[model samples]
Target: MTEFLPPWPLLTAFVLASLALAITPGPAVVYIVTRTLAQGRQAGLASIGAVALGNLGNAIGASLGLAVLFSVSALAFSVVKYAGAAYLIWLGIRALRGGAAAADGGTVEAAPRSLRQVVRDGFVVALLNPKTAIFFAAFLPQFMNPAGSALTQSLALGVAFVLIAATTDACYVMAAAAVMPALRRAGRARALGRYLTGAAFIGLGVFTAASGSRAAK
Candidate 1:
């Protein structure tokens, strides 16, 4: 309803905006970077897959007017926000303690988790973010084509945003992985990675805790 027109005409601008947003640093980006740095590209991709799906769920929910619940219900928002913040901090602490090592200068190859569990962890990380719903609510409307079905337009834009994010995030992950061999060859990076990733997660949690309702991206 906000100057929305035919999608074809608006598509280019939407893509540009989405790219800009995707490139801008956020919790999702930080998470991907941390995962890649802590493990490898594959782990980063796994986390991204879950995050994307979780975001897709939020986008669909936003298209369905779920933000209204957050808008009108402070308790709901606070509960979700706090929960997500706590979970991130917990994960950070766990990473700090474990550091994903086997105490013999080797990675944790023995830790075998099903893809389903990985997906679930990622989904929960995303689902706990109330701000993402708020973000979709506020951000998508600007590019929406009111001439078309508003819900459909929102959904389409949301998917596009997710795709853009994944592409950009993949680039970053790959770059981080590309450097792994160098870091490994140098040795003494295990503790560094543990502190860096743990701090990032904790920082993200703090940022989430401080976020306000209706704050734009």
Candidate 2:
């Protein structure tokens, strides 16, 4: 196992790069933060877990040559990208509708999502984005020792990246949750928060659809 690892210099670079990548706010961070703001810490943490698993799946898929398929086939990439965008848009629309209904019914808050549903949503959000798999495929190879077992090295690097990402994601969740109380102090504010959350989701979806593959890098 140790023999498959990269040299110290390459490993240090990989860790630094992974930290930078994980800290940069992307679709995954936005989704997790939105869940945290709307639901609570628990939901945010659940989303983190689910997204981590999804990212791991993407990493494994990359190791298995799925990224190559996306690279060669525009249609395949488009299919997955559109599916993810559509799902995000759907979530946004649902959030907006829920907010409107709450206002009409004289309620301060929208109904809470179940943890299972949140997990499923987070998983799908992470998994359907082809960029993650492409990123893993593109990024993981840089530090791998050519003489080492490619499969083992890729898997190890992928897991490290995922763990780093999960940690950063948790930090975002904590920060969002910290401010959540202030945002929800008033009924009107709570209602407005829902609208903002919905708009954020919609905007994220649009951005995802419009973004080129270069954005992942």
Candidate 3:
């Protein structure tokens, strides 16, 4: 296992970089925290697991040359990018509509989703983001051992990054879950939370779409 990894110094750098990246909140973190705020710890955990799996899939895809396709083919990247952005926007609209309905009916929150649905949503959210695969392809190579097998090293490093990210993501879920009760205690705040969540989703979608346009240039 050690033989398959980069040199000690490089490995340390990779670990540090991974930790920094993981600790910083991204789209995945936002989605997980939103789930925690809306549902509970269980749903947040499920989202984390599903998103981790999806990220692992992206890593594997990067290892298998999918990232190469995205790098060389703007069309391929755009298709996936738009699809993901559309999905996120749709989720936001649905959340907004749900919140509106709840407000009209004097409810505090939107309809709760099942664990399975939450998992599916999280998985799709991660998997649809082409940027993750592209990022892995670009980021993992910098730490790879030139003497070792590229595929093996990429897989190992990708998995390591995912694990680190999942650990950090779990921390975010815990933190969000802790504050959920306070949000729920206030009737207006609880109702307002749904709109905020919806807006966050929309903002992420717009950011994603805009990033793709910039990348194309």
Candidate 4:
């Protein structure tokens, strides 16, 4: 075990950075927000929980030398990145194909989904996101102590990051929930919700596909 934890200053910096990153809406954040708008608070929260676990796996992968593999081979990075992009695009297509009227014949539209589906889909979405994998691969090493145990330091930082992310994601769900009622009143909002969510997925796909072939060293 790496006996020493990161010093207070380093820890503080990591917390600040994590908070900043969490608050910024990336593909994962977009996925979470879109789900919140399309589903209810419960679904949104569940998705957040699922994604956190997926991210934890990614963090562990980075710690276990996936980062080194990505850094050394541009082809590996490109393959994973494009594969992820294809998955996102396919999700968008699926969303476009499906439709569900509101249960009460109201303007508020919800995707017809069971909680299990929500959790599973959210996990897969997060797990397949190459940007996230690369992000962990790049970000965690900056905080690791070269002379200390790399495994211990990676585990610590990864857990902290996941916790921070889950908290921030919950905040987003609550905030979205607060306005869901009002939005639900507008029939246009219902259609817009579906379209926006679908579009967000497509946008994420395009964004991912546009990433350069060069892997960050």
Q: In candidate 2, what are the lDDT values of residues 1-217, reduced to their tens digit?
A: 4457888889999999999999999888988998898889999999999999989999999998998898889999999988988988888888888898886885534424699989998898889888889999999999998888888899999999999999999999999999999888866777787887789888888988988764552
Question: What's the lDDT for all of these models?
Answer: 0.78, 0.87, 0.85, 0.76
lDDT for residue 123 in candidate 3, whole number 0-100: 90
Q: Using TM-score as the measure, which candidate wins?
A: 2
After the best TM-score superposition of candidate 4, give how far the Cα of residue 181 lies from its true spot, in angstroms: 0.8
lDDT of 1 by residue, 1-217 (tens): 4333345657888899889888887778888877777777787888889899888888888989888798789999999989988988877776666565545565643212455655666678887887888889988888777667787788888888888988988888898899887876766676677778778888888888887875432
lDDT of model 2 at residue 174?
A: 95
Sorted by TM-score (best first), the order is 2, 3, 1, 4
Query: Which pairs of residues collide in candidate 2?
Result: none
Please, what is the TM-score per model? 0.87, 0.94, 0.92, 0.86
Candidate with top lDDT is 2
* Root-mean-square deviation of Cα positions for candidate 1 versus the true structure, in angstroms: 3.5
**Residue-by-residue lDDT tens digits, candidate 4, 1-217:** 4444566667788889989888876667778878888888998999898899888877888878876787778888778778778877877766655534343355432354788988887887677655566777778778766777778787789889999999988898999889999999987876777777778888878887897633221
**Model 4 error, position 167 (Å):** 0.7
Higher-lDDT candidate of 1 and 4: 1
The predicted structure with the larger TM-score, 3 or 4, is 3
